[model samples]
Target: MTTPDKPGLRERKKQRTRTAISDAAIDLFLDRGFAHVSVAEIAHAAEVSKRTLFAYFPTKEDLVVHRMADHEQEAARVVRARPAHTTPLTALRDYFLDGLRRRDPITGLNDHPAVRSLTELIYGTPALIDRMQRFKAGGERALAEALCDTTEASDLTARLAAVQIIGVQWALSADNFQRLVQGETADGRYEGAVRDAEHAFDLLANGLAALT
Candidate 1:
């Protein structure tokens, strides 16, 4: 098997610049709210020209939501990379628990002020919500395709698993986000969140059999 080549120094620097721009944009958005901020203001704050900012982010909303892309294909990746003996659900269970421990933002376990503010901004903005829905659709498709690669699963089976897997992830994290938005502290809920995630994943892994 051929290993994928690592990004060159130039590519790494470009990613750093992109992250810097997004961080700057989120900071600005949080300071004054997303609707009040402009592309020019974000570009200026990031110390990049408008053209350069556009090169990195296609739309103003993309600046805040691009981070979603980082984990968007994760479901597919876990399935494809899992040990041959491991089931896809088991692989995802382990990954999700690790994210909980690390306070991964996607897991919605992270409660940094910036994280909360950005989530609130996205939830408040209709445009961003629509964009994210489309983004997640692509992720689901990727997961289905990955599941198809396994001989044990039929297309119907694969699609069902893909949908259920993504559904659990979105549902669990969303509950946490809503709680945080309602004034709950991350540290306060950390233990319960971990237990909730565990229960959610256990359901996925064991299904009705676990209920019996």
Candidate 2:
């Protein structure tokens, strides 16, 4: 008998493996905290060999926190892709507002205990925090390049604008995460934070016009 063709089989297999590993890592980290978890345990729980797990997630931390890298890259992409008339601050404001409306986990809408625990784990871990800072720096560099592409500003001006925009976002995200961990509902904080973010962006856009 001829073997049946498996359409989209490779993609599905890769996704399944990735999901299994991520779920297993999250479960273990929530149960025992991040520092105590090992790659072998994550591999075992996911029913994959250590080598297979490494193929999906190069590090134990990657299995638990892969989505963050995608988010930072996407933020820079959105700014770069904004319409010619739209300023970078405007693009970032819209992106963050959309995130708030969707109650995205990155905006701290998560209510699960495990999610909160993982946030605490990330904050408490120095290595993970350092990695996150590096990720943010890379994202800022990408954004600065994009800004430079769209404007005639000097390299220093573009870099400074990118730093200010990213720093504001980082602060806002931390505020929302803290609110979530403190048992505040998303709706309770959404309106106030949105207003604050708008004002913050307005200042960036107009107050910094002379510099730009």
Give the TM-scores of the predictions, in the order they appear.
0.84, 0.88
Least lDDT summed over 10 consecutive residues: which range in candidate 1? 203-212
lDDT of each: 0.83, 0.79
lDDT of 2 by residue, 1-212 (tens): 97865868878988888998898888888778788888888888999999998888877767656857687666669867888787667777899888888877776655566666777878877767877887789878988888788777689998888898888888887888888777787788888778877887787877557533
Query: Which candidate comes out best when scored by lDDT?
Result: 1
Instruction: Estimate, for each residue in 58-159, the C-alpha lDDT of model 1 and write its tens digit.
Output: 998899879788788988998899887777777888898888788888978779987887788888888888888887787788888888885357777777
lDDT of 1 at 63: 93
